[model samples]
Target: MSAGSVPWTDLDSLDIASLARRDGEKWAVAPSGVLPAWVADMDFPISPTIRQAVIRRLDTDLGYPAWFDESHGGPLGEVFARRMLNRYGFVAEPTHVRLFTDINQAMQVILHLGTEPGDGVAFHTPACPPFEDTIGKLGRIPRAVPIRLRDGEWQIDTDRLEDEIRGRQGPPCRALFLVNPHNPTGRVFRRAELLEVAKLAVEYDLMVISDEVHSDLAYPGYEHIPFASLSDEIAERTITLTSGSKAFNLAGARCAIAHIGVKTVRDAVDDHRGVLFGQVSALGVDALKAAWTSSDVWLEHVMAVLSRNRTAVAEQLPPEIGYVPPEATYLAWLDCRGLGLREEEPSDFFLREAKVLLNPGPLFGTEGTGFARLNFATPPRVLDELLRRIRGSLGC
Candidate 1:
């Protein structure tokens, strides 16, 4: 797609609600109709199917939510499992699917059960800050391996990761934490890349914790290959965490599911479920079921819109910043090392001067310095304003 054909043209007319500069202030319509390209949430309204289901559920008297629990035989878990298996070609038993409030909680649960205080947990550098914080809070050392953009795609230095895992030799590298279709970078690791990483995990007897919240957002012709699908051995060692919040924009509902493929892994997760991750919300469970089973058309439309937006953003960005278009998700990681801004300063600069908020690269990791993470999920008009703000700030 030509950069010039980017969707910015249509986005020039949106009006976003404005918030107070400080907390506890009166909110009013943003007089300027500034675009909000900051948060991952989409500007487009919720899907009609999901909205109707929610409304219908509220109106109907479904007492006690027994449907969520297996005793009552609700198909929520089965629905998600089937969708995942069908899309990724990984077999997941509905019985093996356990509910969680969110993927972050699932990560904590995995950490609590799989590793000890100060145990080494491996992750790619420039990952979500929450990963590092979660590991630290759990008292595990977050060992980061960098994934650099080369040849228009992000690639992990497997040799470095393997060496680091092996060099630690004694601690045995307890777990490898990953974000397939990665967050800020938007680089979808190929199947071969996943296999090599899986091989290392098996060789070292390590757990693989993969956060695939953005899996469903993959664009046309690009498939999201679940890490578990790489091999049976890998499946045994892996815990896949995903949620409908991302693709469906249902994050506020707070529900995510874990698919534990191996008996040992399932047992491990279940054993600690009581202490760490508790029961999911009744609404979240129902929403997830509705989304996974009946939202294919909505999801396809979202993918198409985001694909167009991604191409648009790629076109507007200067080549010096070196960001290849993402294969999945609405996030775009733009390298800004050339822009003479401190790691944390540019995002703030854009927010203050350009009146646009963006995730600073530093928040992701040191490797993310001189980069900025963007959310392209807003309406086209808002997106145009965001690009204009960026262009003004950069004197482009």
Candidate 2:
């Protein structure tokens, strides 16, 4: 089915009151009557295909998943490999794909298997907090390579990144955590930029753990390049992590796939699965299969709504708020530094005054201070109300 066949307009008009009653963190964490624009999950419903698949599984087979079996070349791995090849032209060997409960678990397992505890891991600053948190929790040094907003574009400070790796004191930098269509900032990195990153990884002999959950959400004009797909040498050094959860609004399913190009690295992760990493749920396996095979239409429609919402933010927000419409994801990284509000963090002010729950910039990293991340994957009417509340609070 094509995106044109879906009732995108009706689906986009989600009922806020009903959403608030749901058990998800995005809605449940916010106070009563406050609009939640904090968590990464979307307010939209799961794809019909995914919903049907779950129901079908519950009705017939609630048994253990045969994900590890080699019959028909492994179900989950085959689906992932086919999707990668058909969608992105990236050739993923089915044997190299591994399943996990979620991306966070995948990261933890990858770190445990690939590098020593004291090794340093580098990633862009103002990043998804989990990347830094995971590194620190694993006894690894978290080296933040900052990205600067220059001329209204978020550009990676490549020279600074190289210097950070080279100037490491105690532990050697062993891996780089890359977020394509970067979170919070939402910069869909260009091909040239990805090539540079690949080159840097090769030069430093660093393993690249690329989180590409937002790859499917790139805007009409932007393209998402898989880091491992750049070249054969880079592929050998890259572990690409992705999931259906982000684009398909299936976070609750808790399913993620990791494409491990290196044989030894794959073996290391697989060996530690039962003890350190938990198994993927049977329902998660079904949802993933349905998502990769039949949910593109639903995803396309969601992207359209998100694109409209992004434009609304840019056109409607007051001059005091700095917003560059993101190239991917429903997240809008607002530069609240110019607001000059009495409060140090704009998110607090928004929550109290505007009655909107936004993610505090400081949570992402020091570089994220004086900013806020807003989830715009809401209905247009609700988003309009949110903007109105903010405008009223600003007295603009």
Candidate 3:
């Protein structure tokens, strides 16, 4: 709809036909012309400032990374804290900030530090797969509590969460993990709603891990409240992870940060940090710095593209697919229940029949079984073609 709003150029500009040209038939995922509308990655080019910043680092010949000791208490940390506070009115102390190579590592380290074997870890359902995987792989029992979708909106099931935490049968739940402006679903919890969750966490004596990686990409007028920011009590027991990767299309850069307010929690998490784990990519650091502090023009453009893409998705998809328009993130979570397709069916149908690639809903969790997560960050033209292919496959 507007310049720089969408991430990728049109599908026709892509080699979509070539990608799926099986005996000259058009396909979307052909080896030579694969249209990767599946993952969170944006096909757009990086900002000039980020590109230059990385190049500036490469000019140093990729030497051992300089110490980020200064960053822990530096202006960068202060800037981050202030920016978040200003945006969400949730004051976070700079002393609580800790840098990391990526959020995935941060999640793992926090899980390892805060939880013990056999402890129950509760996650709001329809979440990122890694949230569940990290717990199970670490020997903690994975407990998923569903979030209710009502009136074309998504809300956490605080009642169910409370029941599980206070229930007689389950083992003591030790931790609660949240994805604010949640993944796939793109549900940006309101401030009061987040406070309710924080209250539950406090009541249960559960440690909190709030992932706000997609917070910045939120659409106009929707506010993203960080669980840790609810109050000092919550902040002290919470670990918040954020990155410029998703919002700025810099996942390849692998730079992120975690803020832990409490001394005991921070120390415990720090104990697990290894030499390789916290090592920041020099280029990644530069790119993140450029992205966070600068590139407003590029970001504005990206947001515009995402807005059009989101609108297009709502208007174009068949009635069989259902979703509330998201408040943030380029990801669209579509309910395929009406299509009579299983959780994995949409992805399979798209790849084999439509020649497109999408993230299957089930990957997020079992609750996501009859849904599909689509990336609408591509150019409008490309998105149109994707819709065309999908419609053709559905014969609708």
Candidate 4:
């Protein structure tokens, strides 16, 4: 059967040997016999449409692309605008969208254009580790706003964050890096919480850099609201970033787009296009366009698999390990602190004993201690084996 018609339970899994042979960081670093459930990358194959699009391009065009000269940002811009309008009820200007190699590169350029050195960027704790590191690398201080466990749910501590922005907790922050369907812990921010953040952004006049790469993965009951879509005022200051990578398993394609709503930032980026940055490859662009336009069925299957795996993780994991199956994403942010493992980072213990590699919690920030993030995007059989090994290791 075509991949689009394949049942979610029939997810094809690569054998350990084949997976390790791949060049991606997910499996390459792990030693033999280790089941790598680490990194944000998935173990599934790419959407058939994305693969075919790239192959078609290979057989056709091999020259420098001509669409780079467009004033309206070419096919990528149009695609983004159409998707935004269709997926969410947001009316986006095609001209406001800009393409980049990936979200990190887009973030770096946006940060350079928007803020001065030493300005603070406050984002949710247990944030994406590389993003936290990127703040430091850019000579900016990262102010952590913790997402605490309350009433058995992970929710943002908006009061504490507001205090930080107001200089009551620390120096007032200049920017707020918002990660919807937040990484590590997959609590998809509700509209009320988002409105609270919007109020903070408006009141504090902070630039909002929203990373919505996981927007497409918000689970059945939760909705992923675009921060910029809240209000025109919010949109003007928000630079929304997303990619086909997380949803379509196109991480290797290296394509991302940003909706630059702030006129000043947009103007600065427009001026520097190609001269400073913004040279997306033909392959990346084509693959992203196809993934966005032609691969809904593939995404639906992937989401179904993720939904089942999310439940499986919560039920199969040892009861001592704290876990709330996320409202979104294929990642399971496990609270291993309750287990009281000898290793400071629970990932280390899992790696050594269970032969399952996971992302260490401390890397996510001060709040990630004694936690570990597991990628559950592999097939059902593989995930079963992974959980079995972990259970055996724990003597549970």
lDDT per residue, candidate 4, 74-106, as tens digits?
A: 769889988888888888888888888899999
- Once all C-alphas are superposed, what RMSD does model 4 give against the true structure? 2.5
Of 3 and 4, the candidate ahead on lDDT is 4
Over 60-90, each residue of candidate 1 has an lDDT whose tens digit, in order, gives 7556665434421134557866886788877
Provide the TM-score for each candidate, comma-separated: 0.88, 0.95, 0.89, 0.95
Show the lowest summed lDDT stretch of 10 residues, model 4.
1-10
Model 2 regions lying over 4 Å from their true place: 1-9, 70-73, 168-170
Q: Assess the local accuracy of residue 391 in candidate 3 as a C-alpha lDDT between 0 and 100.
A: 84
As for TM-score, the candidate ahead, 1 or 4, is: 4
Instruction: Write down the RMSD of all candidates, one decimal each.
Output: 5.2, 3.0, 4.4, 2.5
Off by over 4 Å in 3: 1-34, 68-71, 167-169, 272-278, 342-344
lDDT of 2 at 396: 78
* 152-249 per-residue lDDT for model 3 (tens digits): 78888888888777643578788888888888789999988888888888788888888899998999988888887778888888988998888888
Name model 4 segments beyond 4 Å from true.
1-9
Worst 10-residue lDDT window for candidate 3 reads 18-27
Each model's backbone clash number: 4, 0, 11, 0
